[model samples]
Target: MGSCIICGTDVGSGRVCDSHQEDVVFDFRGDSPNGLVPSRFYRGVVDGYAEFGVFVDLVPGVTGLLHRSELDRRLDTLDWEPGDEVFVQVKGVRDNGNVDLGWSIRQAEREFRGVLVQEPAGEHRPDEEPSDDGDDGDTEAETETDESADDDIEVADSVGDGESVDSVGDGESADGDAVEADADPEPTDKDVATDNEESAEVDATLASDGDEDSAVAVNGESDGAADEEVDTDADEETDADRERAPITTLGDAIGESIRIEGEVVGVRQTGGPTVFEVSDETGAVDVAAFVEPGVRAYPDVEVGDAVRVDGEVESHRGDVQVESDGLVLLDGEAAEAVRRRIAEALTDEARPEGLQPLGGDETVAALADDLLDAAEAVRRAVLESRPIVVRHPATADGYVAGAAVERAVLPLIRDEHAKSDAEYHYFTRRPLDEPVYGMDAATNDATRMLQDRDRHDEKLPLFLLVGAGSTTESADGIDLLSVYGVDAVVVDAAVADPETRDAVDTLVSPELADVDGDEGLSTGALVASLASAINDEVRPDLRHLPGASYWTDAPDRYVDLARDAGYDAERVAELREAVALEAYYQSYQDKRELIADLLFSDGGNLAAHVSEQFREKLETEIETADANVATEAVDGVEFALLDTDGYTHRYDFPPTPLLLDDLHRRHADGEPFATVGVGTDELYVRTTADVSVRDVAARAAEIAPTADIDTAGVREGKIEFLSGERDAVEDAVVAAVAEAF
Candidate 1:
């Protein structure tokens, strides 16, 4: 861990100096030359290098480095010119103490202030203080299911409440504008936790360059002006120049224009819904029309038909609907190829937990499972197996105040002041300015990522928690007053009123799902880490003298309780166990969820993987069987077929037990099983046999007639034709068995 350049204290996990001087007085005067120490005062210079780099005055001189960079939304329209002086606070001091003398006031005021808040230093009996750790939420919101907005394919629903569609471009209602873009501010479309649209953009761009330039260009222009930005006076303007609707289907696009082009994979008429599986190599949306008497039907409008249907495109809730005007089906093979390409487009957003509708109940259950597991992981890593309570803040504002939070986390905290006594801060959002887990670089960076994700999204009642073994340059009190309250601004993060909260309560209940992120510290665990103080937990105990210092400058209130409960001797052991188990379990679940989602969720490519696997199986079987058949034919060998009836596999020509023993005996001499068949009347054996049946059977994949399942297929040789007797057909006479003779 690197110490803050401004202060000698550790900078925490992120390596960022959190030492903020909130009492920054704006001044353009340079106090030092050689560029003031980083985090020092920003000496606005009349002339300097431009862009991104910070400009600081030389120690005791007017010379300064130029910090030129783009402004964020927070800056709004504030333009800083050369010689422009802005008030800044001292964020850091040279670690050497003699390195330089200016301070950085900007960081301090931007929410990166104060040290991590820990428990109010006081000791108490372990069991004496009540722990409110276990979840008691049984709200109705958790059990309610949202309406599905898709047909044919059931689309995944949102986890949190949907955002309010307030305004849009073109002066039209938001209803028609940003149709597909208005997702909730919490968990995203793909199950990845995202802030709101504004925050989501930032979250997507952070540490990675997402498409931001074009989005910004159009965003800057309002509804009336958006159309003017692009040259529309030209007569050669193509459809591509037009503003694209977010939720549109092939049918709709085709209906509006002459070039109605797309590949159709299959057509199914079931339950009065005439479904057309079509895609334009970019995306695949289920298009269905009402099957009416007047509806025209082609002799073969099955799989692999490039169809051009001039129809209206309508977005019904989460689905894209297309109506047909003139339908033209293309070749089967070509359409099939396009269909496959379109299907791949679903991966654009890696939806976690598959495409299944995500409910509040599932979210809560998942979150709970994640919390409990994370606590255990931390405990195990520290080599301790003890019951420990976990504390998670409800908001993303500031760390929970006092020992009450620690007490709220059960057995983990054990008592009212246990967490505070241990110097761990509880959180649900990002701690205004503190390390996630001590002063480790990776840990701090991860925590920062978590905070940015939720903060920008405007989701949550957000809060960050500090945990045991945490230390910072400034005191928590300093942050609570100036930084956390003023700069962090937790209240601004809330998107809806109490009704939304009520809805969340119903959707995310304790009995359903819970948070689980990061193997050791990702996913929703990041939120828990922020809600509660992170812990490494496996360290030597500090000396406990008669009057020991506390996290909040007070003695631990629960230490006495521990002593009274006869835990003084075992307290240390219990503490170690709690910490380690917490870390281990949490970490394990994080990894599991990540992997499971990739392997099973709709965000994954499992369907593609399985499809490839079955196809390969079919291919292999065919190739191998053909080779064997060729060999048998060249050798002039003949085989006869026999019915397998009245001949049970058990107690037959080859006794199971005796056969196993014989095979084992032969295996010692290296012998393989020979080809043999048995019937009730006689035994038939062959050196070589045609195995084409296996290859065809291997190709018998069940295509999905509906969404979420695509396994069945219908073909001439692959069809199961019932006999004349139909349901009552007897086994005495088989209709027909298509075999290669």
Candidate 2:
């Protein structure tokens, strides 16, 4: 009978017992189907897709079929493409040598408990414990198969990658070899050899036979004396070992004894141990501290406290974990040193050098300093490990800007935090229906932040208002965050009121530079520039975003920039339409992965495919609206009106605003045209003339005192008043327009 490689239990033949077969993965080195291990997870690459299922390559010359019947969801919804790395389970090898694959929910490597290197049967067991006495320490006693033996292995240090050896056996060692039961009372770090091997062996023999006093009678010494000697030696070794354990990243520190310094992000108590999720900037890992079962260890520690820990790295159910032996909370000088180290690491990577505006507008160019400040705020939030909340208008332009920041910030968050899901927790992009940060949006944000702080102990998020918070209309919303001292940054292309300037901590606007006319830039263009300042590596990716925001008469310089980035007018338009359509569906969800693919992936042709559907649906709606256009002359000012309730598909694709935008583009031919599409109780107005809806609403309210006219949307150039006084409001609005002309 052979001993199990993992737990040193008596097994019939194979290296691993039945209990551990599923928990471990073996790198199959043999050439034939006979060498394969069934019911184990294997790293695979997505080779291609077929009508039946996806083909995954587990190794070179070995492919498996992930049958559709085993899928948890529909195959078409899979975000995976050809050549992406994925994980699958090996179901079985058929008689014909074809491997059947089962679906593994985990797609990333960080999802596994622990990795074990399994060699062929003929190879030497790398984990075989060596004895200083030059004797093979395999005793004649029956090997224990107690699963609880794993809990007996005491590990105090963690560092490095997957185990090159095997799991521990009996109580000899934790990894492969560290302590030996029969070696000595004071074992060295390598072989755990005792100077008095004869006496130690006698004690081990009596202990194994379940003797009471016989175990303590060895070496003619008392039990207390032996225990004292063992404890003293172990303490001295551990003290010296702490100084030599090198600092490394969590990803690189798996399965090795090492040291780590980080801030405790969270803490949870399992039935037997308290797990502290620690983040050291390079990554995060859970450090488990165990004193007793069902008891809290390190009760003085709280979330956000800096700590220095020494532990043996291990993986627990796919997550990298540390079995901590020493955990010290830092305070005063030590704590300040950790904070300073993190800060230095964060600020060392400077923003792109000598960044410039994507367009030729001097006004936008002059706001470069303010843009730099805004980018710095974002970078600071990430470095400090604070969550960032981005708010943008629910329009094509707003989405473009929000997406640009998201693209730049996500990679930074990933680099700054070790957890794979850090981006989801650290950064969020939320879309607002209106281009105004009204009290409703602000109240929602405040409520969630307060709850997160109270329950989860989360830091107050950095509010990034892109394309939506630059007007006095959003003062109440911005003021809400200020009440709690939450820092906010505003980046908008439109001119903001003086009152709005005081609400935010930092505001970046082209109008602040006193540029002439409104033709200088789009909000998306400005945000793309700011995003470049935040992360320069993504500058090339953001070049087309600016041009995509402009629907008509986009500046020549911006268009040329897009062309230089390999996107011509047609490609730019396609991207804009694709983003708009995606924004319309699941408008609440950020759709982060999907949007990233549509924007950053070079070969997917996702934009072209989605754009085709967008144009077909949009053109159909526009054609219908055009056929129903009602023309009138209000005070000799040409007006184009469409009863959207009667002409447009209210609940379908090509939403009313997009349909109206297309209608205005189709009808405004070299004339000052104002197009109004009136829906149920609301309306949208688009004009080729230089008309301010805010000014028009103010003037129209005076023309008709009871109309209650106000600018419903500054970006859409829309006016909202009492629906019951539609005729009066429209007439006053028309008269106001005529007076301006």
Candidate 3:
């Protein structure tokens, strides 16, 4: 029989009783998995990791699986590496010679009251049992006497010169009194307790002292106190007696302790730790702190607060991060110092110098100031770790514009963040069906951002409207984003409404630069220049996009630029046709990879294959419409009208607007002419005259008093009318076109 080490209960075999098993730790000495006892705490070494669990070797050749489901925290958050010693409970030994382990909160040897060795022969006490003076009779008393004597010597050494032994306790011999050498030197209980109390007081005094003199002694200053002071001052010990390390230098300090001071730009809570993204003057890094599994660390700290983080630098999945030991919110001079440094750095880094437009387009050159402002905003967002969401129309020109900015900004995102997947998290492209940023798009963006803020504590994203959102029709959408304090920038080549200039935070448009609205400038050209300003490293990749955006009459400079970039006229045309055809099918989806392959990659076969489909579909639609064309002459102008519902595929490729554009180009014959493709409830007007769709719709409304007529798409020259008044609307539109020409 054996007595339990904790409660003194008698047991039949082992040192601990069944009720006291948890109070002790067991060392497994068996050679096989079958030798492990169930429900006993055993020490193990980490073997390796798997997706579902971790393997721990309980003995030299016996391993057990510590399933992730049995862990108290996330498996990824476990700092245990291979060969690291850990603690677990042997849950059971299976029939197939496998062992299952459970989580043990007590991981250290000192946390258990006693330890035992479990061998295949039987359970037995370890060689070194815990000392219990009360149970050891006279042998323990002799050991206590020796310890008391040692304590007396320590107390005497702590006393200063000329201080009497009485200062330690009343039990000591009095000053000027002599002790006989033959007298018993054994200490009484009172004397031993007094010595222990005095030793504790001296140890605590040395520990809490922070003065230079006290630090010298604590650091083993027997060599010389002056030399220790010199080394300490050189280190410039700050709070907690440690030197601060800059965040930018953390990459070299991995596996070493460091201190960093910065402003908290973002705070995210993961399944196991709270991650704070701290941005210093040089760069930003993620600092992780855990109070418990899934609990928030440093609840008092928030975004924009200046903080000092003391932690060890570690590499988590190839990204540099810090495991925090302490996080303190700064205030007063400390906070202001960090804030001032960050502000100066941001201002200097955000501004781009030497603004140069691509292809040397005069219109874009004239808008240099506005384009620079937009570029700065994008760069600043990347530095501050704010996400950038690009919204553009799903057209060939719009895709070209959005992709140009995307290629430039993605490389910058990769450089700024340490995570390999930062580009995916920090940049997004969302395509709109129409060339307008209406309420639906704004509401969707707002809801997603708000959810991200509440769940992940992410900063609100900056919205960049490319080739869209430059009309009074999009004002409401821009206002919705403004209501949430989200900044918006608009870059377009369309005839922008003057009200839109005031609606967005930054506006880059040709109209703003006093260029005529009909200057044949495509959005792709303007944004390509803006992309160059944002990231000059990617300027070479954007050389061909501007020319590929135009279906016809591309700017001469852009064409030469594309040719210089090795894309000839045939290749440029193929790329334009391919993008236009793909943009129509998934009118709302951003096919980033597919579009990049067609426009930027060396995928000649892909562009040629898609262009062939585009040509076949366009040619088929034009031939079918031409057979049913009706011609009429009015006031020296020839007007051709086709009933789009009867002559074309109503719901297939080559939509009504595109069909009319191709048909008008084929049969105009250099005369004063217009082609009108009339649908059931809408009609598109294509004319050689400089006439606006709004004017034609207004003139038609005046001619047919009972019909509802209005311009649906000003850019496409589309007018909508009541289905019952299709004939009247078409006749009035033709008359308006002849009168204007």
Error of 3 at 302 (Å): 2.0
Model 2 spans > 4 angstroms off: 1-250, 266-277, 280-297, 314-321, 350-354, 359-361, 516-518, 602-604
Residue lDDT tens for model 1, 315-408? 4322345543234454345345444544454332211222111111233234443343333333221111111222221111112221222222
lDDT winner: 3
Q: Give a tens-digit lDDT track for model 2, residues 500-583.
A: 777789988766656564555789988998888899888888888889998888888889998898889988888888888998
Runs in model 3 lying further than 4 Å from the true structure: 1-246, 516-518, 646-651
Candidates sorted on lDDT, descending: 3, 2, 1
For candidate 2, the lDDT comes to 0.69
What is model 3's C-alpha RMSD?
A: 12.4
Which lDDT value does model 3 have at 220? 12
What is the C-alpha local distance difference test score of each model?
0.27, 0.69, 0.76
Clashes of each: 166, 13, 0
